[model samples]
Target: MATTAQPVAAREAVFVARALCKTYRMGEVDVAALRDVNLMLHEREFVVLLGPSGSGKSTLLNILGGLDVATSGALHYRDHDLVAADDAALTLYRRQHVGFVFQFYNLLPSLTAYENVALIAEIAHDPMPPAEALARVGLEARSGHFPSQMSGGEQQRVAIARAIAKRPDVLLCDEPTGALDAATGVRVLDVLETVNRELGTTTLVITHNADIARMAHRSLHMADGRIARELVNSERVPALALSW
Candidate 1:
């Protein structure tokens, strides 16, 4: 029964949305992906959007991460108006402030872990060294290893390292552990939790697993293209304590 209560001075909100709507145009039909959604993501908070498949969780995450734009509504990332931003602005916003991790590892087949992370750092406004990023994810010794040589969890860790090397303000993870088993997924979640704790990145995770909600500072449930309810975990548990 945890409420959304915390230290007012330190709890700064990052993304705020009101009456958000997103629609997709088919060949001859319009499909509503998200409908009048409202949400707020706070600084340094670990939040979870939990929902069944096709419940608009991914759509909402994409919009927040700037991968997609809402059809209509007020969506703001701090002072930036996300709903009014152009393509160039959105691209720049993502590069400078947001980092993303997906279910699939999506690592470059031909590159080693170090190289994959360094490629992003090369283009970032300000970035940490690839080796340092690797170390943060506990993969320093495997920096030289190629993606094909790594396990699923190791590959996901590498992906997390690449995402955080640029030191983004927000980290958006879309089912980051979907491809791993329980043990492997826990390792990946451990890395994510560590990053949120040590770096103060506002983190949002999209998942169907209810057990994972126990690890979040606040869990928002989505249903039928809208936010159903939210629960704040005043005393959050570790990922290792969760079961399928």
Candidate 2:
């Protein structure tokens, strides 16, 4: 199977990984989560990772987001050497350049949607206004609503708004729609698609659903800690038109 593929038009490579490996020590046993993973993510590209549970999808995303470190090989985001970066450097890297969204919406129950996004914007070096962020996700009207007041999909959009509020260079999402139903999931995917298209934020999404890959510019399939195949879509299907 082909392990590497490029986008149609040449773009600046945002992430370059060569022989990247990640291992976790569990008691006396070492378990490899990623093995010799070589990949290049281009600027403003939307890539989907399809794999089963424990297929190193989240591990690779974490490494890219600076939440975890690789055991071996070189990983670079632009000119930043992620493998050689220290804890402080990694922290700065994440703060300045990366935005992350997990399966769960980590919004505070006590805060409204606007407040939740404003919290992140307040600390960022440069950020869009909280209102603007919520508007991007189509939640400007719901800004005053709390998590309990919104549906699952609405909450997820708010989470996305918070991530993008910082205007980070990259957005890393691990199963962003995993918790929602099919219809609601489509709505969340639409927001991600819109963000990637409009903001030109380089996006990587980890999803178990194969249907989600159809909306991406490129799809990567992983198995047993290695990327097994790569597929490039010449034409992208809109997220709303995708059959869930």
Clashes of each: 0, 0
The stretch of ten residues in a row with the least summed lDDT in candidate 1 is 1-10
User: On residues 42-152, what C-alpha lDDT tens digit does candidate 1 reach at each position?
Assistant: 889899889988889999999999999999999999999999999999999999999999999899989999999999999899998999999999999999999999999
lDDT of each: 0.92, 0.94
Output the TM-score of candidate 1.
0.96
lDDT of 2 at 103: 98
Candidate 1: global Cα-lDDT? 0.92
Runs of candidate 1 with Cα error greater than 4 angstroms are 1-10
Model 2 residue 235 CA deviation (Å) reads 1.3
Q: Residue 6 of candidate 1: its Cα lDDT?
A: 47
Model 1's C-alpha root-mean-square deviation from the true structure amounts to 2.3
How many angstroms is residue 67 displaced in model 2 relative to the true structure, after the best TM-score fit? 0.3
Off by over 4 Å in 2: 1-9
Error of 1 at 78 (Å): 0.8
Q: List the residue pairs that clash in candidate 2.
A: none
